[model samples]
Target: MHDASCRAGLARHGIMISLKRRIADRFHTSRLARSSVVVLLVMLLCLATWATDRRSLHLQLLTYAGSLGFIANSVPVVLLFFMVLVVSRRVIFTSLIVSALMGAVYRINAIKLETLQQPIAFSDVYFLRQVNASVIHLLSHYLSARIFLFAVVSLVILGGMYFWERPLLNLKRLSRIVSALLLALVAFGLYRGVSPARKLYDRNVLRIAPWAPAASELHAGLLGTLVYQAIESSTALREPVDNAAITRLARLEVPDAGAPSPVASQKPDIIVIQSESYFDPSTLAGIDDTSRLLPVLARARLAGSVGQMRVPTFGGGTLRTEFETLTSVPLAAFPKIEFPYLQIHDKTMPSLVRVLKTQGYLAYAVHPNDANFWNRERTFQSMGFDAFYSRKDFPADAPEDGWAIADSSFTEKMEQLLDRESRPVFIMGISMEGHGPYLENPVLDKAMRDSIPVPSTWPENAAKEYRNYAYHIHHADHELGRLWDYLERRKRPYILVFYGDHLPGFSKVYTAAGGFDDHQPASTQMVPWVMVSNLGLKMPGQPIYSWMTGGTILCSFAGQGNDYYAMIQKAQRHQAERRMASLDRETLEGIESLSRLYLRGEAMPGNVKESARQSFCAATGVTNP
Candidate 1:
């Protein structure tokens, strides 16, 4: 009886063990179970790629890892891996679709390379145009080939994971855990290294723009903070200001009363030409003297005051310069992503046109570009211009370049307007012949090139290109001569101040011509500001190199420096006064500190008056109030 009972117990135990083994094997072999493992692996890989590629993700992971121990890091990674598995397909599809759309949109808008370098804001109407194109492009470009490739690769990875899961799952999990733990330990070490300098970040670090979508906001915010901290903590990076330099700057004399007392008595007809890419190429080093790119300007300089005018920016975005010149406003601490013209279409501006109009002057603006470019038509109206003539309004005979109508033709049109208009016209002509794509224009003659002298700084190799630029300058000069001849006969008091909007971006010629060394900061911001008139209304003093922006020109000319001009001038005066009062070290330190803080978006505690501060905030769209 006992032997029979023992045999039964043994058989039952063996059967139970075999049953458990069979159940485990069946679950592993099933299609549903296999699919789940494949999906999990694919999701993990995708998560890893995202974590490594995105700046925000890397920053967050590093921060969190430093705070937590190895085990803690592993827990989040594992949890995220599983979470991604649930939404993997949706996330991948969304990303692909968005990328495709973006590519398509960029292509359709004929978005130039220069436009892409700057920030893009929501206020830009061009954004809507691009979006429309992007949708169409995505359907044509991304939905088929790109989508299929991604899907196939994903499936292959899933298949591989399914086949290998039973043997490799435990090892894969353990390896990931170990790697995360090590990374956490490393992050903690880095935190310790940077702990001592954390305060510097709080004091001096500049914040990046926060415009990413909600899904990315938290990540971008944290990442930005970390980057700021890292930069602040670096001992190698020197602050822009030092104590000794500030003292010297303060002692510098206030501009002597050389410029004529602002001409308050007479309101002359204003002919403001915001010439396109107007920097004299001859100014660059190594250009041949024979090219004579700016001979006419050189001649004019002798007759009038010609010197460097400091502009706010370089390369593209001419409208910002226009805004500065017209409104007497400084460049915003943080530049707007799009042209302010488009952003503030309906808003009023205190422009030269408006001011002249108040004096009963007929104000007009002429541009050889598309009316829609930068939304200038609406902006001009808002700025109080009585009329705006763009490409659409110009005659069909006007010569076309890649960007706009030729400067020569534009000038001719201006001449016609000057002759026809009954009122004292305040005409603003924007040139386009010298606009980029810097290729030579067939309309330009060799004699035209030879007539304009190249600057001493231009490189010899760049003579031809400089000559091309010179041709436009000579043509402009010839046109100006004609206008002056007319003004001479009419004997009307007219003021024409012409300056380059900004320097050209062509690196090879510009850098060499500007006499900038490889290590020296580029002086592309320095442009020609010439105040020329046929009437001998002499400015009071010798030529002065005042570091002034576009907007200051009109106000300075008008003998009134209210609003933005007063604020900037006052700030400069204060800095000068402080330098004179303080020790050299203290002065330098103060200036440096002011510049640093100003660049970083920090308010200058007590320096700026409340009204000026409000104006600054209003112009820049900063919510100070």
Candidate 2:
């Protein structure tokens, strides 16, 4: 009787398994069932991509209004999925592929917006080719374990779907081949904005907000905006250079163009340090102790030129500020190019390094991070640096404040370079110590971190973030004082320009701390800068843009730079004296034209170019090629 019962149970289990397999087979093989699943999956994916994130759902819905614009936004996404479907003829696998891709894009966009306060541009897609170990390590700080697990599970599900799903159609027959080709052609034409598709993006359907990617994304959808930007950037790049504006600016006389240069016998060693995420903590509310936070900056104010500096970018794009300072060209000049380093194709570009090299200075760049980051390893050489010292150049056991090498050890490396080189060296050192995601920093002892003050009303996370930022910045200040002492003790003349790249990415801390005095977010606020020297240099303190800083330093200490730099210095003086509003449309266009010409190794005007060529030839004894 027991054997009979066991046999019946086994037979029942086999019957249940047969029923499940038949159901699955019916769903997979039936045309109607597969089509319905494909449509449902496509609709869900469209909704997900349109929503992007929970925070922006309301704005996205109201901004686009489930009308023709919604169709315009979703058509491309659907066509993309369909394209995969036609190729693979597998509904589940195609949906999984599209889902994974859109998921990654949305996640990256969300992180960029949170950290940089800027939306992702179509140009940022170029970074995919740049991914390596350093990039992965840097990005790891922003990702959580939950996200990692979700990604792993997603991949496993996608793999299962690919294996289980049957092909919707067989393409071996000639009739089926012809049908697929016709459908693919139609889809491709519509996806590329053919006449019928173009009508969907009319003013009634889509409203473009120029220069505001976030607004445009709302006006259309995320994928729709990306398509729009691609069209706009391609068109913008093709526009002719503004030669008339360039000519007009070139004719303007440079202020103190004939000012006597410092005697060649006493060429100072120029050291410019672009501190990472450094800012005046006093600017934020609930922080009144400026001296404790930045004692060296306070002391430097008495001896050097101290003022606020308007950098080109905030939070993360260090290369933007670095480019502005080195090239003396405002990034506002180029609206289309987001990452200047990636877009810059010209080798042997004109920059501060090139300008100083003409004046008998050996230019070197030192950064205690990946040299390949932001394409710096290649772009630095293009900027005419004699050599670049990257993470590999530093000690393997270098101290790190967090994920970044400590400013203390970084400054020591710069000091060592100065000691080793007898030539007049122009060292551009970029620090990593003050970089963000400031949590769990091993360099800051628990006692010291706990001692750091924060707003009592702030949440635990906000307070901890503020404390971490304060601890890191405090070390930056100490290093500044250390470097200043090193420069002062040197027998030879020296010039040190120290400044912050941008404010820290402490959005939560700022919100919890309360509103700022200026009523503007930290993203748009200026950072502090000071220029000190051993030569008893005294100058009026004045706020300036990052691009103007290099030119001002050249004229104030060394001399007028190349004609291009002289024009920049003249513009700086004009802006300083309020002769013109900062970064006006005409001024931006003019500088853009001029900077383009210079980067291409071409001259501006006949006279300006002649004078510049003569000076450059005389200084370096290198005849024009």
For residues 305-326, write the lDDT of model 1, one tens digit per residue: 5655556656566887787667
- Candidate with top TM-score is 2
Worst 10 residues of 2 by lDDT: 616-625
Tell me the deviation in Å of residue 145 in model 1. 20
lDDT of 1 at 170: 30
Return the TM-score for each candidate structure.
0.56, 0.86
Clashes of 2: 0
Alpha carbon lDDT at 460, candidate 1: 63
Evaluated against the true structure, the overall lDDT of model 2 is 0.74
What are the runs in model 2 whose C-alpha is more than 4 Å off?
1-37, 53-57, 60-68, 172-205, 233-240, 247-261, 579-586, 606-625
TM-score, model 1 to reference:
0.56
